[model samples]
Target: MSGDRKEVVKLLAEFSTIGMSVAFSIFIGVGIGYFLDHKVFAGRTSPWLTLIFLGFGVAAAFKNLYLMSRRKDL
Candidate 1:
């Protein structure tokens, strides 16, 4: 019983972190894109790089969701 309870609690903790992980992934992606566009390119790329990076971030978030859903333990 103790082992089972421990497993449940561990799984609960992992699940709880999913939202934060997803958000962080997106934020990091956007931050990189923003840095490249504004600092590296000096506003020449402007919104394009930002938009491209935002899409990448969104794709990464969805990928994280898919992987989590496919977890065998879940």
Candidate 2:
């Protein structure tokens, strides 16, 4: 029914919003951490490495979410 289709669309929109927010939060957190690490700890041990890893992790999460969104079954 049209109503069911509308509902599905609405749910998917909400899900996508949540997924994007999570991805953006991770990206921003990693970026800020990396900036501070290299800025403040340039002469000492670098925590930027961890930020790099976290950035990749966030990117991977976004990729997976994108793939899932493409699936017909959701």
Candidate 3:
């Protein structure tokens, strides 16, 4: 029973952080994209970098989620 409870707790912790990790990854990507677009690039390319990086962020999030879900122990 204790072992089962520990497994459950581990699952709960993993699930709880999933959304946050994805969100944080996305936000960090966007922040970098935004900085490059507006400050580094001087808004010359405008939204292109932002959009590209945003897509990358989404892809990374999904990839991370997939890896997390594939964990055997969890």
For each of the candidates, the C-alpha root-mean-square deviation to the true structure, in angstroms, is 1.3, 4.7, 1.7
Cα lDDT computed for each candidate against the true fold:
0.91, 0.70, 0.88
Q: Residue-wise lDDT of candidate 1 within 3-70, one digit each (tens)? A: 98999998999889889989998998899899999999999999899889988998999898999999
Quote the positional error of residue 61 for candidate 2 in Å. 7.4
Residue 15 lDDT in candidate 3: 90
Quote model 1's TM-score.
Answer: 0.90
Name the candidate that leads on lDDT. Answer: 1
Off by over 4 Å in 3: none
Candidate 1 total steric clashes: 0
Candidate 3 on 1-74: residue-level lDDT in tens? Answer: 69889889878987998889899889978888999999999999879999888888888899999998788864
Which 10-residue window of candidate 3 scores lowest in summed lDDT? 65-74
> TM-score of each candidate?
0.90, 0.41, 0.84
Instruction: Indicate whether candidate 1 or candidate 2 has the larger lDDT.
Output: 1
- What C-alpha lDDT does candidate 1 achieve relative to the native structure? 0.91
Q: Rank the candidates by lDDT, best first.
A: 1, 3, 2
